[model samples]
Target: MSIITNIEDLRQRSKKILPRMLFDYVDGGSYDEQTLRRNETDFDALQLRQRVMVDTSGKRLGRSVLGQSYALPVGIAPTGMAGLYYPEGEVVALAAAEKWNIPYTLSTLSICSLEQLRGSTDYPFWFQLYIMKDRAFTESLIERAAAAHCSALVLTVDLPISGQRHRDIKNGLSVPLRFTGGGLFDMMLRHGWWRRQMFAKSKSFGNLAGMASAENSKLMGLAQWCASQYDPSLSWDDVAWIRKLWKGKLIAKGVLNAEDARHAIDHGCDAVIVSNHGGRQLDGARSTISSLRSVATAVNRQAPVLLDGGIRSGQDIIRALALGADLCMVGRPYLYALSAAGPAGLDTLFTILKNELEVCMALMGIRDLSEVDETCLENPRYFSREY
Candidate 1:
């Protein structure tokens, strides 16, 4: 634990530090979790073609997406209730992303608000949104993001209905956090986390609770209100509506098919993120990396194609790029690190991934991310079009 070697090490540490319900929330996916397993396991099927003789001395990890250059071909994907993992978690993660020069996406349900993050650092971050039942509330959220000077708006088009995560039900990690005696014991065991939470700015959904409380509902009532407001009526029409309202880089963050990717681009999305909601939505759906191949082919460079899920290492990022992803977004990796060691863990996580990427690039004789392609893999057709 002292000398963490990789993301898995961070994962192990996080599992110990985080309470059972919290850890399962971050770790488990929907239904049987078949897609969840595939997200990580699918990477093993693709092998990187290592070349030794060429000069890799001028290597750079930098990759440009939608006119902005990233420190690496990675960004932190939006995760709800991120602050539950650590004290002021979203703020810490955003600051870390700023330091690393990669974008940190603020979730609609994040514990820290956009203003908090903007105040913490002036750097522009991405905001992920889910169209709510209340159009006014959703618009207000959009207005807030614009006020915060968010660089991009990631519209997550999946989850019209919440997936049944068995672990959460079993653990009683409900909307208002109903806890059984055992669940209370489990949470209480992580004393440091809750102790720090007492001093933290907001313990509930930062972006959401304030939205309602300022109007009529109190905290718990607001949580209930927000919970019931996830729009099952969210549709393609809503996409166009949001597109007209906001004039920033719009990224569709939950696309899993070529047609969906094309539709997002056609609907004014600046880019399409090939994701399966980290297998948190549909259980039997294809892994994001597995689907990236065909989606990238369909996109054909019209706009950036980003991959989310199944990326555990720098090598996985390489695989994603070679398959056609412009960049990658990580959720669980950073979450694990943050839960394990707070702010320093974020630095360590980025450091480990950067070094791993650098070493992988060096071994592959790749000068930069632009030099990466399908040819870098031994058998490039590991990703299927069958989906």
Candidate 2:
């Protein structure tokens, strides 16, 4: 209703509009949420070096990641059940990314099917794959991504098994949403969200629709099916198998340490995303930004290193770039913006991030992304500290 100028504003608005379960699913992390809290706090710990008496003309934010050009050095990270944020949320976010000329990754668990998203726009979007217990199903998903003309395959390596998210358990969160009386009451209170989402285009998990039988499509049943599908036996061998199957650029997401980063490269990945699944898994693990410097050093520029987790603003993106990240991905911030005001909120969010990045660059006496490096940072000790 009032002026929504920042990501935090969008977050608050999303809290007000979304049901508690859906909101918690996006907002909360695993166990004690230590990693989740650290992700943002560590960014605050890093201060930028400001320079005044220099030319700040002809600033450029455009960047190329894994052979694709982007208007910004950021991409929309894959988020599951984005439709729960708003009706057809994935499609809306993809549309926004298309308008901005940035990549939008479709999650394997996304509500919109790959075909649906591909049909929505001519631009090629990346596809994120989760290796399930069923190898046949996993291979099928890879084949489907190729059929959909996905330019890249983001293999999420961290989630061999889902983390124990306390909020999700307490709220009884599920794909279709297990509605309790309290949950129903919460939804009733958010009348606008209810009206919009109830009549929304798709309610079931779009990608998994044909795979799941009608009985397994129910709220609790779908949760059970999903739980049973996650293969704890998933390993580097699977990544190798996927690489052999997929001809496009392969990005290994969820690389938090040097060993994993090296393994990602060894398995023929084009890029390694230094992430902890937004702290949704491994709650005690180090934040993505805190691990970026070390991972980047280990990789030694063998492959481009991308980062995701607690990136709320353009200044955060700059911090990641300074720490050795080639590109940054955002998840919750854009979801909150989309939930707050649909596609328009995403447009505003992008505008705010780009403006902030430009302003920060100018203050640092830097005009382009290439000019950003460790020199723009203030505390060297922070980067050296082991997480």
Q: What TM-score, computed on C-alpha atoms, does each candidate reach?
A: 0.96, 0.97
Compared with the true structure, what per-residue lDDT tens digits does model 1 show for residues 261-280? 88898889999999999999
lDDT of 2 by residue, 1-387 (tens): 349777898899999989898889899999999999999999999999999988989999999888888999999999999887788988899999999999899998898899889988888899999988878888989999999999999999998898999999988877777687898788889987888988888887888876656435563555567677888898999999999999999999999888889989998999999999999999899999989998999899888999999998889999999999998999999888888889888998898899899999999999889888898999745868543
State in Å the error of residue 374, model 2.
Answer: 0.4
* Residue 351 CA displacement from its true place in model 2, Å: 0.8
Which residue runs of candidate 2 sit more than 4 Å off their true CA positions?
Answer: 214-219, 385-387
Alpha-carbon deviation at 175 in model 1, angstroms:
5.2
Best by TM-score: 2
Candidate 1, pairs of clashing residues: none
**Which number leads on lDDT?**
2
> lDDT of each prediction vs. the true structure?
0.88, 0.89
The stretch of ten residues in a row with the least summed lDDT in candidate 1 is: 215-224
lDDT at position 8, candidate 1: 96
Cα displacement (angstroms), candidate 1, residue 109, comes to 0.3
